[model samples]
Target: MKIRKLIRDNNYNEYLMDPIYSRLLENVNNLNERIFQKNKLVNLQAFMEGFTFYTSLNYRSTPIDVLPRIISSEFFFKISNYLSARSYVLNKFIREVYQESSTPIPDWIIKTTPYFRSEMIGFSPPKNIYIHVYGADIVRLRGIPFILEDNLRIPSGISYSYKAFEYLTRFLPELSEGYNVLKPNDLEYLYDILRYVSGSKDPTIVLLSDGNYNSAYFEHRFLSDKLGIILAEPNDILVKDKEVVVKTVDEGEVHVDVIYRRIEDLDYLTPGLVKAYLRGWVTIANAPGTGIADDKATFVWVPYLAERYGMKLESVVQPLTFCLYEKENLEKVIDQPTRYVIKKREGYGGIGLAIVKDDNLNILKEIFKEYENFIAQEVLDFDTVVSVVNDSFYETYADLRFFTYYDKVASAVLSRVGIVGSRVTNNSSGGMVKPLWIIQ
Candidate 1:
C-alpha cells in the first residue's frame, strides 16, 4: 500500500518503520478501505459524509484523517517534560515583561505591540501565572520537530482533540487490537486550576464564551459540560459590586468565582468583570493582557528571556526569526525573499502570510513598505505523514499543537494535516485535525 511505501521509502517517515507503527498503519489502511467501500458512496461523497460527521461533533469545520497516527509514549513524555521546563522559563519571562520598569524585552516593542495589556501590570493571578493554559504549534524539519509559534492567549483546540480521540476510537474499536492506545487525558484539572486560582475549595466556575459564532464555541460548550461548569455568554455573565455573577435558568444571579475565558478581547471581558478580577473577587484563567507574551515580535525574545531567567529548553528548539523592523534584516530578505516566509506579527489562522514563491516581487515590495509589522523566518521543508482521505493515501504536510496547563506539563495534543496542495495545517483553513494516538 502507499502508506507502507510511505514508511519504507520516505526518509522523513523513518520513525514509521518500527514494527508496531507499521502494523498500526496496516490496520488503518484496511479500515480505510472498509469505511469507504461499505458506504457505497462515491469518493467525494464519502469524504464529505465523513467530514460532515466529524464537524457534527461541533468542531468548527475541519476534516479529520481516516485513521489516527502512531506516536510513542516515550516521545510524548519527553516532549511534555521539555515543554514543562520551557513553561517555567516563559513564566519567569512573562513576569519580567509585565514589570513597570526593568525588563529584558525592548521597551519600544512592548509599548508598540497591540497585544500588550496594561491592565495586568499590578495584578497577579493564581500561582502568579499569566499563562494558565498554553498551546504551541510544532512543525518538523527533516525528522526533528521545532516550535513554530506560541498561543498563550486563551488557546483553543484541546477540547476538539479530546473529542476527536473519543469518537475515532469508538468508530474503530477493532483497530486497537494488539496495541495499547491510551486515551487522551481529561481536562477536569482545569477546574482544580480554577479553584486554586480562585482560592476557593468549591468556586462557582463558569466557562465564558464569545458565543456560538466563535470558531471554538464548541470547545467552550464541550469544556463547560465536561468540567460541569456553567457555560455563560457575555449577557449571561454579570459583575455586581466587583463580584461576578451569572444569570441562570434554575438559579438567578448565581455568583461566579472563576471565569474560564474563551474570548480574547478585553472589551468582551466586560469592565465589571475586569474590576472583579482586579479585586480578586473572580479569576480569569489567563489574565487579560497576556498578549504581551503572545505577540510574534515578543516571541523573538523567548530565547533571550529564557537565558536571562537562568532556564533554557533542553529538548526542542524553535525556528530563528528575523524581525523586518530592522533595516538590515529587510535588506537581506529583499535580497532573497524566496528563502523565507513573510508573516504579519498580528496575523493568525494562516492569514497575512506570504510564501514569497516564484515571481512574487511586486507583493513583497508592497508588503515591505510596512516592514515594521512583519517578520521573516526561514522556510522549513517539514516532514509529512501519509494522510489517508477517501481511501487514498496522500503524503501530507502535518504539524502538532501541544496544549499545556500552567503547572508546566503538556496534557493534550491536536495533530493537523493539510490535504495535498495546501501549505498550512490550521483547522480554520481547509486543514484536517486528528488525534495523535500514542502507543503506550
Candidate 2:
C-alpha cells in the first residue's frame, strides 16, 4: 500500500482480535486495579516499581491496548534512510554556520541560548559528527508524517522504546508472533560510535547524569546498566592531566574515553570537562555546541539546508515555521495568534510552548516585546489514534519520536499520546508513551 493511502485509511480494528491486543487489555485492567489499590502504601510501591522515573508524581496507567501504529515497510525505510544520510550534511552545515557566522543563519537562531555560544570555534569533534544521537518529533497530518522538530542535543526516551518493546514481546508474545517487528539495536550502534570516536578497542564508557534528583535519572541508570558502563554524576568525574576521569571506590580514578551525557545544559558541566571535550582530549556522544542546530528557529531552515547540502528529502514533511527575529513574520504571528504555536527557541518538554489564541494576544505581545528568542509555527492538526485511558479507549492526539543514530533508525519508535483533551504530546505535558511497531 502507498504511504499516504495507509496513513489516511489507518484503522486499528484490523488487529482488534489479535491475541496481543486481548492480552494488553487484560494487563491494563490489572494495572488499573494495581494503581487504585485500596492500600496507599501498596499502590505507591507498585507505582514506584512499575514506572520509576518514567512518569511524574501524579502517575497514571498508560493505555497499551490499541494496535501499534503501523507504517508501510517501504515508507519506513525511505524516511529512515533519508534521515540517516542527511545527518552528515546537517553536521557540516551547522559547523559551517558556526564557523563563518553566516548571515543567512541568524545569530538569534544559532545562539538562542548562552550555552550555545561556545568560544571553541576551530575545535572539532573526533569524527566530525556533531549529532551522534537524534530524535525527531514527527506528526502525521493529512496522510503525511511531518517533522515537528529535530532534537539534536541530549534527546531522551530511547530506553523507553526499548523497554516497551521488551515488555510487549515478553508479556504478549502472540501479538509479535507473525509480525517482523524491528528490534532495537541502539546500544550496539551507540557502542560502535563511541568506540569509533575514541580510537580505543576497550574505551572506558560512562553515562553521565546530573544526579539522582533529575527526572530522567532512571533512564540514565537504565542505559548505564544496559550498556554495561559506569553511571557517573558530575561530582564523580573530575579533570586530571587534561583528561576526563571517573573516580571509583574499587578502581580509583579511571580514564574515560567516551561520555553519553544525559545532562542538557552545558553550563552545568564543570569547566574541566568542557575543556577536555573542546580540546579533543575526550569524546562526547553528541559533541558540545550542537545545540545550535537544535534551536527551534533553526528547524525552519532544515529544508533549505537539505537542498543546499545536495541531499533530497521528499518523504519528510515539515510545518510552516517563521523565526520571530523577522518583523514580517512576527507581525503575521501576532495577527493570527490562534493559528500559530509560539515557542521558545531553546525550550524543551513543552516548557515554553503556548498555543496562542485571541485571548492570549496581550500576554504574547508583552512576551514578544521582552524576548526575541521565539519562533512561530503553524499549528499542526495532527491525526488521532485510539488510546486507552482510565479503562476506556478514546482517540487522542499522538506524536512519534523517531530515534536516529548518525543517519539510521536506532531503535523502535516511541509513540507518545496526549490525554483526551490535551494538545501537547509530551510526557511532561500530561502525555503517556506507547510502544510503536512497524507492521510488515
Candidate 3:
C-alpha cells in the first residue's frame, strides 16, 4: 500500500506495484527513514556538498522508488540504439553542413548563426568525427518519448550519473540486487577516446574547463581526476609554435595532445587556439564549431536529416518545432505565443525559456521583432513519476539525459524529475536528479 500510494498516474506503475517491486520500494524507504533518523543519510551528502560554488543540484529531494524507475533492459536497448542512429545521422548532416553536400537547409539560416564556421568548411577532426561526444534530452509525454534538445557541444552529466550509480547503489545495496546493473568503464572509455583522437600512445591529455564560475565545475574536476587528465582553465591554455599546450603546476608547460574541452561556445576559443586545432596540432573533443547541431533550429531539422540519411529517429518522438524565422510560423507563434514554449536557439541549461504562464509575451514579441533566434514547440505534459521532496513523497514529471558517443550508442542515463507544479526538470531550476538503473 505504501508503494502503491507513492506511485504516480503513469501507465508503467502496474509493473512496479507487483508484489516483488512493491517490497523493494518499502525496503528502500525503510532504509531511508532509518538513515534519516540516525543522521546516516548525511553520508551521501558528500557528493553534492564540500563545495560552496557548485550548488546547482537539488539534493533537498531524491527518489526512493529505485526499483520501479529502473528501466527495462529491452527499453534501454531501444533508446540507446535510437540515439546511436540519430547521432550518426546528425554527424553526417553536420559534415554536409560544413564540408559539402546538397544542403538540406537554406543557405540563409546557415550564414545567420555564428556557429557556421567558414574556416572549418573543408576541415575535419581526427577520425572524421565532428561530434566526439553527444547527448539528448528526452521527456516522455503520454508514454511517447520526445527529444527536448540536442547536446553536441558538451554532453554533460555522464560523470554525475556515474558518480551517483557508483556510490548510491553501494549505499543501498539491496535496491541493486535483482537487476543486472550495466556499469561500463566510463573513465577508461573516455581515456581511450582521448587517446585515439590524440593519435599517440603517451599523449598528454587535458580537461579544459571554463573554471569555477561554471555550475557544473565540480563535474569537470571530478572527471579530470577520475580520467587521469590534467584540468586546465582557458587562461592556462597557450599556443606555442602552432601547437596547443597547457601550463600545469606540477609540470612546467606540458604539450597537450588531446583536449577534452568543455567551453560553452566558440567565443571561448582564442584565435591562436583555433588556428592550432585547424592545423591539426592538437585535437578537441566534439571539435570546434560543432555547436551548429546544438541550435534549437537545427533540432527542428533532426527528423529530416534522419529521413535523408536513411536512418530511423524512432527511439523517441520528435517535438513539433515552429521555426520562427519563417513568416507563417513566426506569425502563428507571436499570435498565440503561450501555446508553445519559445526557446532561444543557442540556449542551454533550461534558461531563456518562455511559456504561457510566464506572462512575458509582450516582451517576447519585441525581442522577436529584432531577432529571429527563437523557435517554438507545442507545450508537452510529460509523464510523471514518484518523487520525494524534503522527505515528502509525491508525483513529478521526469526528464532523462541519455549520453551517446561516436563509437558507443548509449553509455549512461541521468533522470531529473520536476514535481506536480514545476515545468522545468533542470537541477538548477529546483529539479531533483534521480538515478536511473538498468534492469538486467
The top-ranked prediction according to TM-score is 1
Q: What C-alpha lDDT, on a 0 to 100 scale, does residue 355 get in candidate 1?
A: 72
For model 1, the superposed segments whose C-alpha errors exceed 4 Å read 6-9, 14-20, 29-32, 35-60, 358-363, 408-411
- When sorted by lDDT, best at the front, the candidate numbers are 1, 3, 2
Model 1 lowest lDDT segment of ten: 38-47
Scored by CA lDDT, what does every candidate get? 0.72, 0.69, 0.71
Q: How close is candidate 2 to the true structure, as a TM-score?
A: 0.85
Q: Write the per-residue lDDT of candidate 2 for residues 1-440, one digit (tens) a residue.
A: 22223323555332232333443344444454442222233223434555445344643533342335555566678778767866766687767865655635655555555446456576667867778888888877755778888888888877667666665565445445446766666677777777788889999998888876676666787778787889988888888887889998889999999988888764566556777787777888788788877888777887888887788877777789888787788788777688988888888988778876423565586557745788888887766765545434556678888878786676567888777766688867667676677655
Query: Which segments of model 3 are wrong by more than 4 Å?
Result: 1-3, 6-23, 29-32, 35-44, 47-68, 265-271, 357-363
Candidate 3 lDDT = 0.71
TM-score winner between candidates 2 and 3: 3
Q: On TM-score, who's better, 1 or 2?
A: 1
Instruction: State every prediction's TM-score relative to the real structure.
Output: 0.90, 0.85, 0.88
Q: Write the per-residue lDDT of candidate 3 for residues 221-308, one digit (tens) a residue.
A: 8888787789998888999887888888987898889888888654455447777888999998878778888878888888878899
lDDT by residue for model 1 (182-272), tens = 7776475566667787777888988888776677666777787778899988888877776788999998999888888887774754657
Superposed Cα deviation of residue 225, candidate 3 (Å): 1.3
